[model samples]
Target: MDKTYLEINKQSWDEAAHRFFGRNPLPDYGPLAPSEDELNLFGDVTNLNVLEIGCGSGHSLRYMDQRNAGELWGLDLSKKQIEAAKTVLKNCHSPVHLFESPMEDNPGLPTNHFDIIFSIYALGWTTNLDKTFANVNQYLKKGGIFIFSWEHPIYNRVSNENSTLLFNKSYHEEGSYYHEAWSEPAVMQQYKISTYINTLINNGFKIERMIEDVRLTKEDIQRDSNRWYSYEKAKALPTSVIIKSQKL
Candidate 1:
């Protein structure tokens, strides 16, 4: 495992937790980057057990709670992020189970317990996608869903500072890359689309849907206006990718 890179990224998340939690209130189901409603991917989570991986400050968990999910669990690598999540869940009177651990660690979660396991813009930070997906498979019930979204591999290829669609690295490169999105440098892993799909298949998941979410309409750009890119820039590139799969 890339322990050093993971630690650096974890610290970055810990430091940004306060500001991120402040900006995003509980039950905020706005799209992570793509215009698609990720919540709808679950097709009605009412009375279903759900777990969210890398759930920063528990906003997404609280959203599941609001949808009347049977049980809610969230796991994160940053202690500070879990601390803020605890506060948010407490204030909302939500009985959410929160754990602080990397996705690869499994965090001693129960097997075949969750009806759905999901993440948004989080899995990209993981150093070992195979282990993470395998751990998720252990916790999810047979036929249960695994939904996640992350920075598109092609999108990550371009330089963030300028609109030039030039790649300093190969699209198939798999390692840590630093970005100045936060006060401290943030590290994320880049993998090709085939790698993601193959990893899911090896972990006993059947690909149900794969979406390369590009800027579609004026509303899409406006919805993502708060991001680092402008309307024209966003329109010129694919912003994110979402996958919805089921455990076999």
Candidate 2:
């Protein structure tokens, strides 16, 4: 029998948690994207109750602490990640709460309570988008905001080869798929850009803003092709999408 998605991802993240402790944190949306200092997604987070899903290593929560949020809560699927978050947030100023749970399932968090809930490069880990976003809605108060970022739906289909860009896979194919020659036992889902927007709308969220621009200048694009998600490739198109929505 094959291992379940949750089981496999939990094991994978347990081993990989150390590499991601403080990487890709807040103040940045995603790979090669503009910093939050410029985007200002959550300006004046002061005294706001905030929650983070897939809160790997808790660095973003610490950032919220520095911004003086009223309370901080986070959850992740991996035990190693939850433990790392605890360690990372031990000395933080804000009152902190952490849970070990997958985003696909509810974990008794207070409903209609949080002022803001965000996930940084982590919403992609959810196996069920509707369930995940529904839980996000249940946890947030009326007019509260939910912000998340993920790799652009089209990023995986384009390749930079010998100074030329090539489109490989069919972009319309959206489902759970994995690269054959790649490593890691975990699986990922491919979503059409519109799929996310439509799903969030169905989940009772009002789309506030969506960002897909990579905001890089001539100096920022790298020539190296060996790197996974090369800046050269990201310069041609957006490597990630950031969305902010309000609970309606």
On residues 111-196, what C-alpha lDDT tens digit does candidate 2 reach at each position?
Answer: 99999999999887778888888999999999999999998989888877887788888899887765343356776778888988
Off by over 4 Å in 2: 1-3, 179-183, 217-226
* TM-score of every prediction relative to native: 0.88, 0.93
Error of 1 at 16 (Å): 1.3
The lDDT per prediction is 0.77, 0.86
Q: List the residue pairs that clash in candidate 2.
A: none
Model 2: ten consecutive residues of lowest lDDT: 217-226
Best of the candidates, lDDT: 2
- Clash pairs for candidate 1: none
**Compared to the true structure, candidate 2 yields what TM-score?**
0.93
